[model samples]
Target chain A: DTAVSQTPKYLVTQMGNDKSIKCEQNLGHDTMYWYKQDSKKFLKIMFSYNNKELIINETVPNRFSPKSPDKAHLNLHINSLELGDSAVYFCASSQWGGGAGMETQYFGPGTRLLVL
Target chain B: EDQVTQSPEALRLQEGESSSLNCSYTVSGLRGLFWYRQDPGKGPEFLFTLYSAGEEKEKERLKATLTKKESFLHITAPKPEDSATYLCAVCGTSGSRLTFGEGTQLTVNP
Candidate 1:
């Protein structure tokens, strides 16, 4: 069974188009995250939701928004996408507690978005 | 500011060759340090989590050790299947988010 899964493994869209990437995790984790890996392979966190509550919001542009209907699902919606948004978007989940080895995160098989 | 930097961005080794990868970080308060291995077209697989200095964990041919300011992932007799991009990330007391390094890509040839 796939622990974490994402839709639209490869997405190619034109500029100014809006797109959404869906993510779901079966690990029953409380924390979910959205990361963007640019062409330089630098992974940066964009947003994080803990138990469906917004926890971490980085310095991302306003065009990008993340919605978590519940703890098991997190979706990212990009509005009026630009060429600079072309990168690999990854979804990750984790269960954090006051203990050792509980901070490990399991990631989904990323969604590659290409804005032409 | 919190940051994680990995050295020797890419390395190529023959089968059975042994080497070590470095993960250096600068954070205000350290919560945990994590190591992950990522294959092409797939997500990252969790490997180890080091909480404090002098802590060590090993699996198969890989051993991870943590220090005050850095961590090392040592690989011995690595095979082709062990080749992947190793990522290091850290979480501090200020937040639950992780700051990730640029990752080191290792390639082992049989």
Candidate 2:
């Protein structure tokens, strides 16, 4: 079974168009995250949700919003996307706790987004 | 601010050749260090996590070790299938987010 999955493996839209990417994890993890990987292959965390609670919000612009309906699903919605929004968006999940090896994250295949 | 820097942006090795990748980091309070392998057109796959200095973990032909300021991933007798971009990340005590390094791309030829 696919532990973590994402929808719309590829997305190409206009400069002003809005788009959303869906992510789901069946690992029964308590924390889910959204990450952006730029063309340089630098991965950065954008947002994180633990049990449906917003926990981590990076320096990302307000155009990017992450919503977690439950523990298993986290979705990202971008409003009025621009050319700079082109990158690979990845969704990850992990069971967070105060112990060793508890925070290991598993990532989904990723959504390749390109804004013209 | 927490940061991670990986060395040798890219490496090419013949099959059965051994080498190591480096990940240097600076964080407020270290929580854990992670190693992952990413193949072309795919997300990163988790490999190992090192919680503290002097810690070591191994699997198959890969072994990871951590120290006070950096970590190393050693590959022994690597096969062509072991070729991928290796990523290093660190999670500090200040937040639940992970700071990742620009990965080191490894190319192993048969």
Best candidate per DockQ, number?
A: 2
Off by over 4 Å in 1: A96-102
What are the RMSDs of all candidates, in order? 1.8, 1.6
Q: Name every residue pair that clashes in candidate 2.
A: none
Error of 1 at A4 (Å): 0.8
Superposed by TM-score, candidate 1 places the C-alpha of residue A61 at a distance from the truth, in angstroms, of 0.9
Shift of residue A75 alpha carbon in model 1, Å? 0.6
Model 1, residue B31: distance off in Å is 1.2
How well is each residue in A1-116 modelled by candidate 2, as lDDT tens digits? 99999999999999989899999999999989999999999999899888999888889999999999999999999999999999999999989773222488899999999999
Give the residue spans of candidate 2 off by over 4 A: A98-102
Winning candidate number (TM-score): 2
List the pairs of residues colliding in candidate 1.
Answer: none
lDDT of 1 by residue, B25-100 (tens): 9988898899999898788898998999999999999999999999999999999999999999998876667788
Per-residue C-alpha lDDT of model 2 across residues B1-110, encoded as one tens digit per residue: 88999999999999999999999999989989999999999999999989999999999999999999999999999999999999999988776678899999999999
For model 1, residues A4-87, the per-residue Cα lDDT tens digits are: 899989999999999999999999898888999987678888988888988878999999999999999999999999999999
